[model samples]
Target: MAELRTLARPYAKAAFKAAQEHEQLAEWSQVLTIAGQVTANKSIRQLLANPGLEEQKKAELILEVAEDGVTEQVRNFFAVLAENRRLTLLPEISALFNTYRADLERTVDIEVTAAFELTDEQQQKLAQALSTKLERKVSLAASMDKSLIGGAIIRTGDLVIDASVRGKLTKLADALGS
Candidate 1:
């Protein structure tokens, strides 16, 4: 996993930079996302792995599948990836590109798991608090997790605030056992 990310970083960064310079971040994001999804299809993966398929043919197939989303810049980008045999890294590249785009837009997506459904007011308050805390626009993805028992667990990027009742109870149990 780490190795793939390491190899994908340069390509992702290059794509991000080009998109930023051209003021086409949204278009590039869409292109990468569509291309990534296309490559992840079972048949597409098999074709990509087939040694008999030419690199140009593989690139063409991907572009054809993502016809609506491809631009000239994206086409060239795919060509470069194909030529370098880094096509398998599309998923990682797309993910990293999204991270870069979010950072540039000063936005962050946070997942909030609570014991019960959150009210609109509750979600609004949480978003406001997180926006204030992170100095970024907060987009909440709320879900119910009955196992939480009570309270909520918030996750954003690498940070997690496990304030759920189940989590506290488990922590207490561990402390007592220790």
Candidate 2:
């Protein structure tokens, strides 16, 4: 998985640069997201892995599946990937591209799981607090997980705050065991 990320980084950076130069970061993001989903399909993966299939055809297949989001620039990007036999790296490239986009946009996507649903006011307060804490615009998404028992777990990027009762109990158990 790390090797795949290493191999995909250059392509992701190149795509990001192209998107920035073209002033179409959102469009490129959409195209990459669509292409990634298309490539992630099991049948599509098999098709991409077929040695007999020509590179251009592989690119075309992805483009056809994601036609709604494809632009000429993105089409050319796909062609480059296909030529280099890096089409299978679309998922990693898309992820890295989004990471780059989020950084440039000064935004973070936050996921919160709690024992119960959060009210609109609660969510707004949490988002405001997180925005101030992370110093980035927060896009908060909330979900219910009864297994949490109480409190909530907050996740954004590589950071996680496990404040749930279940998490606390697990930590207590580990401490006692130690």
Candidate 3:
């Protein structure tokens, strides 16, 4: 998984640069997402892996399977990927591209798991507070996890705040064991 992301990073960066230059970040994002979904199809992936099939043909097949509105630049991007035999990396490329887009837009996705459901007002307040703390727009998704016992866990990117009763108990156990 890490290797795939490493290999896909350059392609994703190149696509991001092109989209930035053309002021078509949103369009390119959609194009990459559609292309990724197309490549994720098992049958399509097998066909693309056929040694007898030409690179251009594989790229053409993807473009056809993808929805309409793909621009000339996006088609060319596909060709490059097919030529480099990196078409299989589309899923990673698309994810990286979206991460770049989110960073540029100053937005972060947050996940919250708690023992119980959070009300709309509570969610809104949490989002606002996180937005202020992170200095970025927050998109929060809340879920109930009774196993947590009480309190909640907040996760965003590489940061995690584990405040649940289960987490506390585990910590206390570790400290006592040590």
Every candidate's CA RMSD: 1.1, 1.0, 1.6
lDDT string, candidate 3, 17-115, tens digits: 989998999988988898888888898789888999999888888777665657788888988998899999998999999999999999999999989
Worst 10 residues of 2 by lDDT: 62-71
Q: Write the per-residue lDDT of candidate 1 for residues 2-70, one digit (tens) a residue.
A: 999999999999999989888999989988898889887888888899999999889998888676757
lDDT of 2 by residue, 119-167 (tens): 9999999999999999999999999999999999999978999999999
Q: Tell me the lDDT of model 1 at 62.
A: 81
What local lDDT score does residue 71 receive in model 2, on the 0 to 100 scale? Answer: 76
Model 1 alpha-carbon miss at residue 58, Å: 1.1
Task: Output the TM-score of candidate 2.
Answer: 0.97
- Cα lDDT of candidate 2 equals 0.94
Ranked by TM-score from best down, the candidates are: 2, 1, 3
Q: What is the lDDT of residue 135 in candidate 2?
A: 94
**Weakest lDDT window of 10 consecutive positions for candidate 3:** 62-71
Q: Going through the candidates in order, what is the number of backbone clashes in each?
A: 0, 0, 0
